[model samples]
Target: MARRRPVRAPEPLRATSMWRVDQVFLTRRGVRVEVTCSMVNDQGGLRNLSVTAPTDDPVQAVRHAARFIAGRGNVSSARQARVRWAREQTTTLQDELIRDRQLEDEFLDEFEETLSAVRDQQR
Candidate 1:
């Protein structure tokens, strides 16, 4: 058997992968949760990235996900909360509008009746 010399690996272009996470954020969507990462691209510009951890640890992923969750600002829990409030407001406003319409109709009906009564009295 001949002894082979070990070949050295080439230097990596960057210290970390472009998808590497500088921070993480945990986001909840309804009962489910997802992880997001904050990373600098090749250009070194700040960006929110959707990615996965090498070990697939939710806790570690959440740490990077925190960056995505906060920076991306699309958390489902908060969105659902806002949506619930909006729906409630819409329902209340709709009810009020219907009530106002009913009141207006009654007022018009009464006004016509009063005018008719005045005409009868004149006769």
Candidate 2:
């Protein structure tokens, strides 16, 4: 009798939530490109990046996504730049929020003072 080979178990899976896709755009050449975006918190930390490429052609899409996810090539560089730009935008918005709050406080103080002056004049 011939000896039978033993079956091997699959490798463990990694965390899938680390990837957050911001958008996906296809080129004229029919190549699908996905943008894995990272969110920057108030503390300036990058929430992990995500690159997901799915299409009607499962084989091709997997190949493309794997290459991009590996951080190998221009696509990877572009994704990194995009993440940096997004982080800067978040920082700018945070600054604007602080400035607007300050302005609102000043306006409320002035309005209260004007009301008090009018009441005193009527007395």
Candidate 3:
């Protein structure tokens, strides 16, 4: 077996410096909306970005904002994963709300039947 010399890797190009902004806005309804990040593009031009959430919770608002920005900004594996996770959470919450409403309806129907039976026995 022959010994092979290690090859050195080339240095990466210097990354361009850019100013970024992340802002949170509150609506009259107490909803917190946020912009994950805003920055100039490779062309030295600013890119327009809009991200908002109708949720009152600050944490949830930021996550939703990141989901929106991820779609318009760079397409990276990490960003895609975050977006997918946010969507899954949203779906799960919606399913839970539907189930709760159904349970409430069932309870109300049972209560009405019990009240009717008691009234008939008392008559």
Q: Which predicted model would earn the best TM-score? A: 3
Model 2 bad stretches (over 4 Å): 1-99
Better-scoring candidate (lDDT), 2 or 3: 3
What is candidate 3's lDDT per residue for 1-123, written digit by digit as tens? 999999999856656533232222222233444333334444455544555567766455545554454343242212111111222334566643332233223323433454455556659
What range of 10 consecutive residues in model 3 has the weakest lDDT sum? 75-84
RMSD, model 1, all Cα superposed?
Answer: 27.7
lDDT tens readout by residue for model 2, 16-101? 32332222222222354343333343333355444545554433433354344433211112222221112233357664333223
Which of 1 and 3 is ahead in TM-score? 3
Per-prediction TM-score, please? Answer: 0.26, 0.21, 0.33
> Judged by lDDT, which candidate is best?
3
Pairs clashing in candidate 3?
A: none
Candidate 1 displacement at residue 69 in angstroms:
15
Q: Rate the local accuracy (lDDT) of all candidates.
A: 0.38, 0.36, 0.39
Model 1: lDDT equals 0.38
- All candidates in order of lDDT, best leading: 3, 1, 2
TM-score rank order: 3, 1, 2
Expressed as tens digits, the lDDT of each residue in 1-123 for candidate 1 is 999999999856765433323433434444444444444544566755454434344344343433333333222111111101112223466643332233223323433454455556659
